[model samples]
Target: MYASLVRSTVALAALCVAYPIQTQASDPAHESHHGKLGTVHFEVACNEAAQREFNLAMAYYHSFVMEQMKAPLERTLQADGSCGMAHWATALASLDNPFGWPGNVSAKTLADGAELMERARKTGLKTQRERDLVDALAVFFKDTEKLNHAARAKALEAALQDVAARYPDDSEATILYSLVLSANFNPADKQYGNQLKAAKQLEAVFAKEPDHPGVTHYLIHSYDYPPLAAHGLEAARRYSKIAPAAAHAQHMPSHIFTRVGAWAESVASNTASANADGGKTWNSPHAYDYMVYAYLQMGQDRAAHLVRDGALSNPTPPDHFAAAFSYASMPARLALERGDWAAAAKLPLTPAAGAYPWAKYPQAEANNAYARALGAAALRDAEGVSAELARLQALRDRATELKLGYWVEQIGIQTDVVRGFSAARSGDVKAGIAALQAAAAREDASEKHAVTPGPLLPAREVLAKVLLDSGDAAGALREFEAVLSKEPNRLRGMAGAALAAERRDDAAKARDYTGKIARQTARADGGVDGTQLARLSVTR
Candidate 1:
């Protein structure tokens, strides 16, 4: 993750989704689409040969999305007289691919689609449908203004209205549409039964096209989404069968499976590729990150053992450079994430592995992760984290050079949280208070980009804990109460807050929140372990 983005509140409002081309089934008998194709049918080929979703969609699957879309697209075009231009809304959606694939073609497609959609609107599009996928894809992309279940539902419904009407039989649309709709439902708090409806919609898509890639993927996500709806093992089996081999695809699907209870199947593809076979491949570093997560979920000891081993064993393999990285990714990322002095002694090649924080993970997360990895070697490990700390500073400078406010505010947050933690832990009460004030300042500055919450909760907990340890019960009570006001169920935050309130002798506030914390903890399963709970109880 970029260092600058580490503290950002991303405008996750309208950016994640982008439509792409139709692809056919990728699993048809090999003769139909395989092996140095003497007769390569563009539709059924699934190799990672090109960057365009249109290019890969056909190859990855054994069926054709174009065929499913043919009639309605034609009718839509004829209805508006733009040679089915408005029909390409989804294809135009594909233009947003940031990675360089589809090359100039996507650009041309976007320009052309933009003009045509405009012409169609002015020329009186038959239904005025979406007026070129809505002024621009961004308008329909995310509904930032709306926060509740009703708003999310409406925004999602409105986004897919065109696909649902124009291509009723397109299972891809059905699956994708439902996936968007389902994401809004918080399974933990279903002020509406919309989450259940979303699940049924996903089930409907699966019923219609059990093998459809997006449907299968969305089905897994549906099961994982709020409501923790039950998913059949058969569904997992089917997903395992048709899953994409690409690192990108594997990353998401594996996590979805993990979330939905697919266990062993979760990281199968990633671990295989990460284990490597002395050839170039495309299992990405990001994929490696997700693989570690999946492995941890599956209770695999030393989740990233294979990835680090493969990197240490081979310098280069095949596919992309990442496929065969000969040396372990920079000695830096390793020391940050791993805890072995033995691994550190070997030292990976220079220009080590590092990533931009997801704007959500910010530098604070990376720094915290690095700090925790210190374990018994905290003193010696300080040097490596310092180097990373410098890199984080450099990243902020770069973001500043580019005039990226989001990154600046985000990096500031990272600096604040880290500074706050250090100050509070070092027994610098006034300095900790000052650092926390800065932390809140940075977080507030990055509000638009604050889609995912940052370290605000933990930072407050540190301050509150410091106050409690110092016997300033009144100050501790205020800090913890403020934490709860900001984050209703921040595990550690709640725990620290509850304890602080009790210490201040505020019986009612302390008792009410203690019960709330207990209930929230039960719902959170063991994410907040017993040791953590032990810190909060005023009672046995």
Candidate 2:
């Protein structure tokens, strides 16, 4: 009997070690110098809710709910007596950012996030963190009034201050506070205190939870935006090393790696993702998207191998249209990059819906990506791209009818750019510039309210080409100035600007721009004439 009891006891201990009731760490009290216990968790949730990756971040949030069952409700409340972390996790998933994935936030994402937060608050949240988060949320969700940047910042700051007061040493609260501040940083200030603060908080959190995938991924992303070269690249590399199989691990990191000019590291990260976790789990399209984009970055074919073609076509899950649409359009994008218009045919204007219910999803990332992809791929053939343009034109009409200014304006920018390109190709220089100007106008209108403006780059590039073709050197200069102001390294734009300057007899400036473009693109040796411009350049 004694021997049997000992064996059973050993088995129980092994099970506990394998998977604890919550986290393996022994801090049941979750103490800080001042706060009671879980106050910081609530604050963390609030901060996370405002992030661009809130959808992906929320998947890992469910673990908090499972952990809460092990501890008493009272024990979970912290310095301000906020409820456990789960409430805040759900809440965070619910709030929408003013600017969202790429540049703009959709009404649907915002509504969903707001509704989720409101549900928790109404449920009589049992802690101070919950109350505080709710109060902050209330100010954020004011009905379609002014999209007041200042007001939102103030509310988030107050929540952070309240949470940080008693839990100064709490890593979660600190990280959340820093993220809120960083998101609001204005580059014109010449001081990046908030960005630095977020970076510091991320450093501290990663030290404690080095293996925490979310912390690692987000830390790398935070680094990519800042100008810090060494530290940011190192962090990006570290993040790739840890979460080698994250859904977007493959190509997304390229944005970071290329930003730092770490092409080798970027190539390695993409290769690692392709070789190791190409299809780790079935139906996770992001995995395939990452793999394909990574492969393309290394100059490999962009086709994803599934036993059945198109089975994994839409890699984006329903809740994450931004990623899914990006991945879904990769095949078509690759075809265009390699100048294979036939191959790009798969991404039609009216793209066939994927296996997922993305049409019902928020942000319409898939819809817009598919629409834009059509225009991008068909740029070489005016007639071919026209069918796609018509589709977008119809969508814009619908959006206008529905009073969806954001979508109407956005799609209009795309249509006008395409029209400008088409007009230039058809020997209508005057009409082309007019269309380009229209596109530019829409772009300017879109920027005022957009957080992640998608079509801006393409529009500017197209407009610059038209201005140069029309012998409008000054206009071309203004267009290139706008693009270079934001992205100074625009390869084609620089070349076009140089061409324009050369025509206007600004020999030195022309030489400088031309040299930069030639070095950037080895094949940029030819001069720009109406005929060469029409044939070599894409209309859309």
> Given candidate 1, what's the lDDT at residue 8?
25
The parts of candidate 2 lying over 4 Å away from their true place are 1-84, 94-158, 165-167, 180-216, 219-231, 242-252, 260-264, 270-319, 338-351, 354-390, 397-409, 434-457, 464-540
The TM-score measured for candidate 1 stands at 0.47
Candidate 1 residue-wise lDDT, 446-528, digit = tens: 33111111232245555566577778888877777665454434445555666777777888877776675554333222243
The prediction achieving the highest TM-score against the true structure is 2
TM-score of each: 0.47, 0.57
Error of 1 at 279 (Å): 7.2
* Tens-place lDDT digits, model 2, residues 49-115: 2221222233222111112232323233322233334344544544433223222244564566567
For model 2, the run of ten residues with the poorest summed lDDT:
31-40
